[model samples]
Target chain A: MHSIDFIVLFGTLLAIALYGTWKTRKSHDLKGYLLGDNSMKWGTIGLSVMATQASAITFLSTPGQAYQDGMGFVQFYFGMPIAMIILSAVVVPLYFKLKVYTAYEFLEQRFDLKSRALAAFLFLVSRGLAAGITIYAPAIILTAILNWDINITILIIGVLVIIYTVSGGTKAVAETQKQQMVVIMAGMFVAFVVLLVKLPDHIGFKESLVVAGKMGKMNVIDWKFDPTNRYNIWSGLTAALFLFLAYFGTDQSQVQRYLSGKSIKEIRLGLLFNGVFKIPMQFSILLIGVLVFIFYQFTMPPIFFNKTETDKLATSKYEQQYNELSKQHQQVFDQKRVLLGELVAADKAGDEESTTQLTERVNKLQEQQESIKAEAVGLMQDINPDLDSKDSDYVFITFVMKYLPHGIIGLLMAVIFSAAMSSTSSELNALGSTTVIDFYKRMVNDSATDAHYLFMSRLFTVFWGILALLFAVFATQLDNLIQAVNILGSVFYGPILGIFIVAFGVKYVKANAVFVATVISEGIIVWLYFLSRAGKLGITYLWFNPIGALLVVAIAVVLQAVWPKKTT
Target chain B: MLKNDSFMDFLKTPEYTEAPVLGNWKAFYLTSIIFFVVELLLFSYLTIAY
Candidate 1:
């Protein structure tokens, strides 16, 4: 980050944020603060909804994922469009007719207050912890690449979010998201163009893709049936379905996005818009990662992308041992590069057998690289027990710092900040709304005046913001922020989605069935997840969503029929 | 697609609308079938393709 670009980047971000605060300054009442007085149209609501879900993790780890894995991860979102359609058809109209401020509000009317509080508490606990991971995701990288102090970056991001949110409330969050989404999209386009220009001049896009294809990075459509395989077509469609259904239907952060819409129709349109574009947008980001993989083919990439580990290796007593691994890694890299060149030539010259041999050699080189990285990590662990060794999260940022020009570097930095703020602000905004409307006002004092609720909303916003910042400070144990949230959501979302699906779809089953079924489903899901992690079960995290939801629906129906209870 | 008026008949008929009595048996059955088919097809594709 040089002076000029840093100035432009900071100036632009601060201006947009300040402008949002100013624009929403007149939001004096509780409805104004929480729901923007229902003045926003579907377009703004749609963008805000997308921005909230497409957090800093979406920008950071996703591309890094694409760079390492290719566009196949996009398949995981294949179920999203269908889920969105279902939400629009069912959940939207239910909430609109009920005129509920929070999704949990309906649980009280439909079931009881205890059930409502249970759902709300679960949301607060999960969203609260997840917020920190989202904030820390981009901050860790910026700290590493620029050698900027991580704590300072974390504080700056936290304080900026707190300031604008404290001033303008949800109105500012929505307004700023509209602008942040634009900037994020534009900055990514710039990143993609810059990478294309950096590729070999004569190869063109097709050969670059062919290069990516020759590598295993082009595996887009894996129709694998293995439950443990996270990104195959099955896990993606099923697990992603549950995840999306729970997220858009039950989770307050997303529920509140549609809640702010003027009518059910507007809400439906907003959600439909997100559903249509979500998959394509993810595909594009993953494609950028695949391109980065191709970009490194012609360039020298570090033996390990995470500098924290390699730095430990440098100072270790086994520096000699580390040096040997480095040599082997470099030798393999060169060997692979030569073979890749030969593979491309052979492909062009129509030599099938030579192509086969070259493919084997390239795989051998990548395997050697992995072994070298693992050995180096082991040495670093021996040298200093406290050293961080994860490299998957650091790959894309390492590429950006080593290759991209200075001006665009600052823009990409802003993109990270934008993603963090957009997502965090949404979380804080939704948390405050749920607290005031669902808990404090509804359960504690349902007759509280609009002004009091509004004041409490701002109060909770500041409270949760501080809580998220505190969580971000201690979230160092998470290897990748993106994966951590999904893990949390997979456990919680399945049962939550099941509760809603049963509420709408299962007419005979009352809330006891769902409540009991949810408890059972959640227990089983957690047990299964732990078992899978321990290598006993083969279930993937994605499948947790559908499995838990279905389990609740199935169990709840049977339980209710066997042990009948009066309807609410 | 089910016609709006025809679909509306199941849920919004005057008798059911005036007094809540769970009148959408056909809609319930149809929706159940649809979800079953979708989930089954998705799983079947995975099993066969894998």
Candidate 2:
């Protein structure tokens, strides 16, 4: 990035963090530190809930996804509103009824202390690593674009979030999140309009969608019953429902957002507000990606988006071969754009056979582009033999740096950093709260006063922030932040949601049945995960949430009936 | 001045409600239908028209 861009981006983030710390410096007790003193309105709660969930991955990788795939990935959230409704009517009230600090706290009241500890342990492990990935998301980029050390970037961003979060606690997180959401939305909107303006005049927005549509990027809904299809209606509805429940219901990051509300009704209103807005927000972001894909159609893009490897090739003997390949790659872009124009004209003229032929030819040219990219990656590996070649994560950033103008580019860059901070800050804040209220204060030192717990909460926040920084330094080893968060959620969200479903929905299921069933269910789910990854099972990873939840609930119910206990 | 209150009474336990379970279900369904209509309209414009 140029000097001006860097100034605007980092300056905005630092200013917001400083503002948050100043705004809520008086949170001197446990309730204020952990739960924001139960004084937030539905608007702050609503925006915080959305901001907490909207990670840097949502900004960076999702548009890249839309550029490649269209708008269908949004089906994954079809279950969210249903899940939200269930939470608003059921889960929110139960959490409020128990007057708990963390969602896992209720598991002990309704079941046993072991259940609470188990749930909290699951949350810490899942959210802690996720916090690391969130930190990694934008840090990886700042290091890449700024040509700085990746570890330095990670530490810089990590400390920025930790300082305010540790000092001001939950109020700091919510207040900063509110401002961050405003910047995030405004930046993204400007980026979207800028991307649109950068497109060619003749190939307007409608024509661009037609080209994307012809490429089969607009498949928004798939009613097919295939378990392997990741974003189809069935996987999205049932499996996504359980995943949402586990995430928004049992997960502390989300649960704590609403748990800070002053009343159950406000909590419901806040959650339901999110339910209504989230899917469309995601769809809009993905739509921006799809538009970016079309923007690259007329324009020539990098053969390999991962500049780190591309830089390595610049010094190697293979640089000559990479240059030759780039010439061919440019030719492929010329051919693809020519074919897309013909395809648009053919469809406009109502020529069925010509349209089909144009689509086929266009797809073949697209494949040629992919093959050239594959060749570039292969050449890069030959240049350094140990380089990571999967560059899907770098696609969007490469586009922005190459195509966008200066000021807007900086704002979009700020959007991504904001997303990373929002998600990472929430994760650190949640991890600290859980560790203090659910574990340290609850188990080790139950007699501590509010001020003492508040201190511990801030202490743990700083500790987790450092840990997440370490995680970010190693994040480049992973493919992308978006995939990282989903993969992490798929691992633990299922079994945790299963226990809660039994607790709330099936009241008679014995604790022993649940405890035993969770272990067995998790084992089987792991087996299924391996099978699917090995291509042995046909089920997609999205289906794992429902499958795991159903397995535990079904088995526990059967087990509870078999070993009936006397009424309490 | 900041006024903070612990919301102990906000928990709507099943027994705390005056309405019957079936009535609550009806209210839920009604709320859901309203949500569906609003969402359907919102996305239809946000997608096709935008």
Candidate 3:
């Protein structure tokens, strides 16, 4: 990156962090530190909630996902609006009425201490791992751009997040996230416009869409009911619905965002804002990926987008084989580009016959390109067995660096780092709150002074931040960082949501029954995940949310019937 | 500013006499749902048209 890029990147990040710390520097008590003094307006709460969920990975990898798989991935969020509405209507009021610091505190009131601890433990495990990935996602960007070691990048992001989060707590996380979201949305909009301009002069936007559609990248929905299909409308509505319910209703990271609002009205409005805007925001991000895909159709993308791996192979013994693959890839792109030009012309002229024929040839060439790219990936794998051969994650940043102007490049980098910090701070804030309020405060010292508890809150933030950093440093074996984070959440969110579902809806099932059911449900979820991993189960990961929640409710009901009730 | 209402009391407390910004909670909810439907239709059109 040029000097302008560094200035934009560091200037944006440090400015937001310092602003957050300065704004919330006076927070000294548990309520102020953990709940932001309950003074945030709906807009701040809404933006913070959005920023926390749309982490660096969303900005970085989602476009690549769209480029590779198509826009059907947007289906994964179909359940979010419904989840948000439910949370706003049902969950937020409960938290507001109870005046709870963490979502798990509500579990204790409804069930028992053990149940609360179980849910909190589940959250800490899932979100702690996700915090690592949030850090790791932006680290990938810096590592690629600066050719720096991935560990150092992870440390840089982790340390920056820990500083503000541990200093100002939830207030800092929320305040900075508002600015970060603005930067993120602005940068993404700029990039999208740039992509449209970068397209071939002859291809107007509608024609570009037609080309992308003909190439199968415009697929936004599938009505298939197959459980194995990850992003179909059915799994999205059911499994993804359960996932969102669990995430927004039970996960402290999201719950904490809305809970900081000035009132229930503010909280509901904040959630409603996210529900209304989130899908559109996601669609636009994915569309940017589709635009990037179209841009590369006219201009040749690398045989593999991951330069770090490709550069190694370029000098290794496999260099000759890699060179052959590159030639084949270039040949396919050459043929495909010509066909795409014809396809666009035919599509523009409304000549169905030629459009169909050209589209068929273009798809055939795309298949050839994929095969050649696969061989190159195989060569990289052979060269270094530990390498991640998936190059889609590198697609967007590669485009930004090679194509975007210098100032915008820095803004985009800042956009990514801003996302990383926004999410990591929220996670660490939530983690610290949960660790203290639910576990440390309840289990260790229930009578600690406010000053002592405040210290513990900051201490726990640093602790979780370090833990997340360590996990990110070692988390190199995951597949498609975005999917890995979601899968991790899905595996645990189900049981936690189930515990809450029972606590809210299944009142007859007491704490003991729910607690036992939670354990069994978690075990079943893990077994199901392993079975699916081993090719024995065909269920998609999203389905785990509803399955686990339902299992807990069902088992708790059965156990409640059999177990004798004892008066406490 | 902490409300000490029980969960049952919370249920009894009317949540939406009116929304803070929008006309009413029902209107806001309906608007969000309508937005969702419009997005779905737009995406569906893209899918079929493409």
Candidate 4:
């Protein structure tokens, strides 16, 4: 990386963090600290909500996911628009009516203390761990790509987020996110434009799509109803609906974003903005991946995306084996390149028979190429079993580093760092608010002065930030920890959503029955997760949301029916 | 501020009846849904045609 790149990167990140801290330094009250004094407009809330969800890993892994699997992943977000509508029409108004600081506070009002505590505790466990991952996921990828020290990268992201978030609280998080979102979106747009410009002169936008489509990378919507399929029309529409409901409706991280809105209208409008734009944003990212795949078709891509692991393979005992595989991979690439030229020609000339024949040859070579790449990954795994063999996360950064110009590299890096901070700040801010509002204030001391609560909130924000940083540093040595954290989130999200569904929809089911049913449902969900892991169940992880959610409602309703009502 | 209404009553409130800026909540929601449907159609066409 150039010195100019380093300057641009640090300059952009520091300016946003310092600006956020300076802007909201005077927000001293609990409401101001936790809810931004209800001063945020719809635009800020909307961007903040998007920023909170779009972690660094989303930018890194998504395009890579598209490159490998195609655009079918876009279907995963099909439920978001309807989910937003539901939140705006129903959930937002209820939140406004209650005037609650945290979503869990509503549980206390609707059910009982135990129910609120249970929900709040689940959120703390899941989000607390996730806060670390938001920092660690990007830091690992950035360090790998840039050859920077992992510990330093983790500290820079974690401490930078902590500095502003601890200084100015929720308002700071919202304000900084506005700048971060600009960086992220602008960086991605620039990257996409550059990709288009760099493509072979013969391949215009339409031609590029044709090339991608012929390779089956343009497959966007899968109509099949396979229960085990992770992303399809059915899973996206149904399972993802429950997940979004739980995430946007019940999760404190997202709730805290819109809860900071100036008015109920702003909150509604803010959520609606996400609904309208999220799919397009995701599609654009995936398209960048497809474009990268096309670029690699003309120019030979590395046998594996992670150069660090592959670089080490040369010195290891498998040196001869790795070299042979590399030779095989290059031969496949050469043959595929010739076939692709013909395929493009056939496509241009409308030669149906030749197009079909050329496409088959190209695809066969592509399969052979992938098989060699898989062997390379297995060899890496054999060298060091602890290393994660999946290098999709490395794909985008590798492209940026190799292809993009110096200053643009820094800006893209800033885009990623900004994403890491944007998400971690919100997580820390939400964690602090939930700790104070849901647990500390309600359970420990409700009579504290506003200033005392504000002080404690800042203290808790610093506490969680440090804890997340600690987790991020420690997370480096663990294999497959990010996926484990994601699974942990899924396991808890359904049960949490289930509790909320019963609280909102099943009014006949009171507190005691719902609490017991939640415990039982949680146990059942955990068992199901293990069963699926053991290959005893054929369901995808997304299905866990609906199953767990319905289980809670079903169990609670049954329990409520048999149990006698209190004569209050 | 903390009114404990049934789920149906909550849905019946003015907050759900009309969007403050858009005037009608149902219309606003329909617009969002319609936008999403159009996006799906466009993507579907791309998939089949490409």
Best by lDDT: 4
Best by TM-score: 4
lDDT of 2 by residue, A442-474 (tens): 789999787888888988998889888876776
At residue A82, candidate 3 shows an lDDT of 89
Which candidate has the highest DockQ of all? Answer: 4
Q: Once all C-alphas are superposed, what RMSD does model 2 give against the true structure?
A: 4.3
lDDT on C-alpha atoms for all candidate structures = 0.77, 0.80, 0.87, 0.89
Using Cα atoms, each model's DockQ against the true complex is: 0.06, 0.11, 0.39, 0.45
Models 1 onward score TM values of 0.89, 0.91, 0.95, 0.96
Predicted candidate 4: what Cα RMSD to the true structure? 2.0
Model 1 residue A21 distance off true place after TM-score fit, in angstroms? 0.4
- What tier of docking accuracy does candidate 2 attain? incorrect
lDDT of 2 at A379: 83
In order, the B-chain TM-scores come to 0.49, 0.45, 0.57, 0.55
C-alpha lDDT (0 to 100) for residue A426 of candidate 4: 92
Candidate 3 residue-wise lDDT, A1-568, digit = tens:
8999989988888888889889999998999999999999999999999998988888888999999998999999999898988888767767787789999998878777888888888788778878888887678766976698999778767888899999998889999999999999899999999998999888878988898899999999898788989998888878899989988898899889888899988889899899989999999999999999999999999988888888998999998998889888888899899888888888878899998999899999999999998898898999889778787888999999999999999999888888888888999999999999998888999997999999999999999999899878877665566566666676888888888888777657788888898899989998899899899998888888899999999999999988747511
Candidate 1 residue spans exceeding 4 A from truth: A386-389, A477-487, A565-568, B1-50
